[model samples]
Target: MTTVLERSPGSEAPPPSSSPLTTDARGRRRKATDVTMRVLVTAAFLVALIPLISLLYEVISRGVRMLSWEFLSTDMQGVFGDMTSGGILHALLGTVQITALATLISAPIGLLAAIYLVEYGKGRLARVLTFFVDVMTGIPSIVAGLFAVALFALLVGPDYRSGLMGAIALSVLMIPVVVRSCEEMLKLVPNELREAAYALGVPKWLTIVKVVLRTSLAGIVTSIVLAIARVIGETAPLLLTVGIVTQVNTNMLDGRVATLPVFAYSQYSQDALGVGADRAWGAAFVLIVLIMLLNLVARFISRRFSIAER
Candidate 1:
């Protein structure tokens, strides 16, 4: 037991011990990499933000000068030439009516189709429907306008141009977007919930109505709002279908009607300087504000429903 062991000459040397300096250098290297990555990500974000900030600044600065109570309350019925005493009431009314009609037409159809696709669809029929929807989604806004125009001309008369026609055109553009978004939202619902409902003797339709739709209500609303936003700014469809009018026309089926986009286009085209240009900028500003309000409303609804679900 008193004898001590010794290393032979042919044996390998013992491994070197790690030093504090080596560990510290490794840690510093890792920290440096993390810092570099963070800086790069932040720089990228700022670069992306530059365009948006610049756009907002330009629009707000140019457009804010023309905004007033008078500009929003009256119509361009009598004001002509270099006269600056006109408003966009008619255009605003037309936009609201046409867009609302479009929503009414598209929302139910889109929601129902999405429900079928998500809850009941199967086999080849579903695939065909999906394919058609994909095709419709890519259809140009101008083509939708022309299609509506042709359909109306064939059904009614070749001289027809009305807010209803514009609504029809917008609905064409909006439905596919609604369907896609609603389908994705409905798919996000858990299967376990559906199964639980079924186990309780709930019918498939009732389960979809009560459990599935209620659960995804917020998302559905959001999708609808997004669809509305997508079509609301379109100029070609409204220009072709709704036409231009100076006075307010509440009846969507009657005569010509002006919309915000068309109004802006007409004004800008009439005169790039002076009163017409001012009116154009004002209309653009108003449209932007309207969209912002819609987005805010959607967010509020989403938050409320999310809280209710919790």
Candidate 2:
């Protein structure tokens, strides 16, 4: 018996190859989409950086000449007018001291508050605290300074102003930031870690401190650094609370302080040209450098902690 191999009309011959144009069209579409996306993202990034680059260029160009050792070491205590005799010594010192004090005062309190909100929060109390924290976060820096002034004046006299006062105001601003950042970081810690700790018979507090905080320590540090950064450049609060002086006062409790922000303000506002202008630019450069250094430090710490975790 002979078997016949019959095929349908189109199937009688080998199937036709896919059209090259259709395949090419799809490939072209995908390529175009990818290129378009890349171009858009790169353009957006460059646009965002333009202002930053311009500002940096201006500051460095104007400020580089004033970065001499003598300019950095001397204070404008007795210098007057267009005389360029003093450096930012007093202002730099006060900035460091006040910011350091503010960080010390804010960090631990914020960390604890964050822990409470993340680990133990449940119900109405947490909600109330959260609402208050959100409110505090939005409070203006000037308001914080004013509040600090009013509190200190009420306690001491209406004539109270000191580096400590400035620090207190900065702390008030920093605490809410730290709290919010730390709370978010803590929430990122895995539930499994907590469960494992519980399985191992670890106490609740120990689990939180060891398993949770250690897991998110890098983020916490970064957030605290952010809080520091937030307040470091605030001119209004420091100006109001610290009340700048030409002379450096190491005793934060007793005398007015000269922070970089306030120093820059005083220089620029008092002298828009000549030596004062130069000094203002110089102060601004130093401030930018300080902030950059802090960011570098935070990056280093974050990397170190992350590596240790891994």
Candidate 3:
């Protein structure tokens, strides 16, 4: 039997393509969102940079003429009525010395405390210590300085202002920061590494020293840099405990000191503007440079440690 093909019923054609207007509307919405995000990002970046740019501009305009080798090298004691005579050398030296001493005093203690809290301590005491640490972190810088001064004075008599006292004040301020940072770093260390060390018959202390600390050394160093940076610019503590002087102070235990912050403060607290203002701007510029250098050093140290870890 021959089968004849049946004729198909009439059928509507497929709907025509969507209008260009619809496509254009979707494209416009996407473009609008993109533009909004770009604008927001640009605004945020500019906001972040405004203060820095303004500061740099102000300092450069006021200080560039006054920033000379003599201005950086000579001390301000004998200089009178002229911005060109005094330099930041003494203050810079004191700043370096005090901050170094403070870091040395704080870093070890804080790191050990963090190790104890993270590795050994358990339950309630750890919690209490942690809470106290948080509280310490919030303590005002001036309060830390006052506490140091009062405590030291009570112990060693009232005539006890020295560079060492300033260091101690800065150390008190730095410890909580170092502790918090180190504790976070230690916590980031994997438990598996500890277990493996234990399985290898290594002692807990050795395991921590060789494994945990090694793994977290970069972070620890970064914490230390942060601690240094935190205290480096502290004016109140140094002002109260160290007692600013124009001369360089090498002895932490004996004499008054001049730090960059104090030096900058003294310059800015002038009776009349003009030259003193110029000196203040110059000192500020120097401080900014010092801080920037420190940040670079921190980055370098972190990167080196990270590479060694790998």
Better of 2 and 3 by TM-score: 2
- Give the per-residue lDDT digits (tens) of candidate 1, residues 141-254: 999999999999999999988889999999999999999999999999999999999999999999999999989999999999999999998999888998888999998888
Tens digit of per-residue lDDT, candidate 3, span 249-310: 79988878999888878777863476777777787778777888988988888888873546
**Better structure of 2 and 3 per lDDT:** 2
TM-score of 2: 0.90
Off by over 4 Å in 2: 1-38, 307-310
Q: In model 1, which runs have C-alpha deviations exceeding 4 angstroms? A: 1-37, 307-309
Q: Which lDDT values do the candidates have, in the order given?
A: 0.93, 0.92, 0.87
Clashes of each: 0, 1, 0
Q: After superposition, how far is residue 125 of candidate 3 from its true place, in Å?
A: 1.1
> How much is 11 displaced in model 1, in angstroms?
21
User: What would the per-residue lDDT of candidate 2 be over residues 1-310, giving only the tens digit for each residue?
Assistant: 9999788777656689876644788877887898999999999999999999999999999989899999889888899977869989999999999999999999999999999999999899999999999999999999999989999999998787788999999999999999999999999998999999999999999999888998998999999999999999999989888888988799989888899988888888888877888899999999999999999999998988873657
Each prediction's TM-score versus the true structure: 0.89, 0.90, 0.86
Query: Model 1, residue 124: what's the lDDT?
Result: 100
The window of 10 residues in a row where model 1 has the poorest summed lDDT is 18-27
Q: Which 10-residue window of candidate 2 scores lowest in summed lDDT? A: 18-27
